[model samples]
Target: MKAENLAKILKNYTSGWVSISKNYKKVIASGRTLRVLLQKLEKMGNPDGYLMRAAKDYSGYVGV
Candidate 1:
């Protein structure tokens, strides 16, 4: 996935609450708030893809 595409997904959310697939093609996780979004990511392992959004909103995914 391209950084540009990830940016596009993030724009939709002003807050840091979204997770995209490794290819940045699909949204694997998303939340209206940062906390919820993070919980989702935590449940998931470090996916091949990457995450985008404000640093304050996301700190990266944690593994189970």
Candidate 2:
């Protein structure tokens, strides 16, 4: 898979909460690449968690 294609997929996935449903789970379980990416993202934290908060703050320049 190309970077552009992967980016497009991820962009689409991140567009809404419903995107993380069973279909997405099936996609992640379909192969190693997504599993590894999911692991890395987990290590970085996720799902309304700290890393997401930090990302929001960083992007919004709330406390630069």
* Candidate No. with top TM-score: 1
Q: What is the lDDT of candidate 1?
A: 0.58
**Model 1: per-residue Cα lDDT over 1-64, one tens digit each:** 2223344555556665567775556777777676777777788874555554533332353322
For all predicted structures, in order, the TM-scores are 0.47, 0.24
> Against the correct fold, how does model 2 do in TM-score?
0.24
lDDT of 2 at 41: 50
The pairs that clash in candidate 1 are 22-49
Question: Which 10 consecutive residues of model 1 have the lowest summed lDDT?
Answer: 55-64
**Which parts of model 1 have CA positions greater than 4 angstroms off?**
1-16, 46-48, 53-64
What's the lDDT for residue 52 in model 1?
A: 49
Clashes of each: 1, 0
Query: Per-residue lDDT of 1-64 in model 2, one digit per residue for the tens?
Result: 2211123223333311221222223122111354454565566463331111111112333211
Give the clash total for candidate 1: 1
Off by over 4 Å in 2: 1-32, 47-64
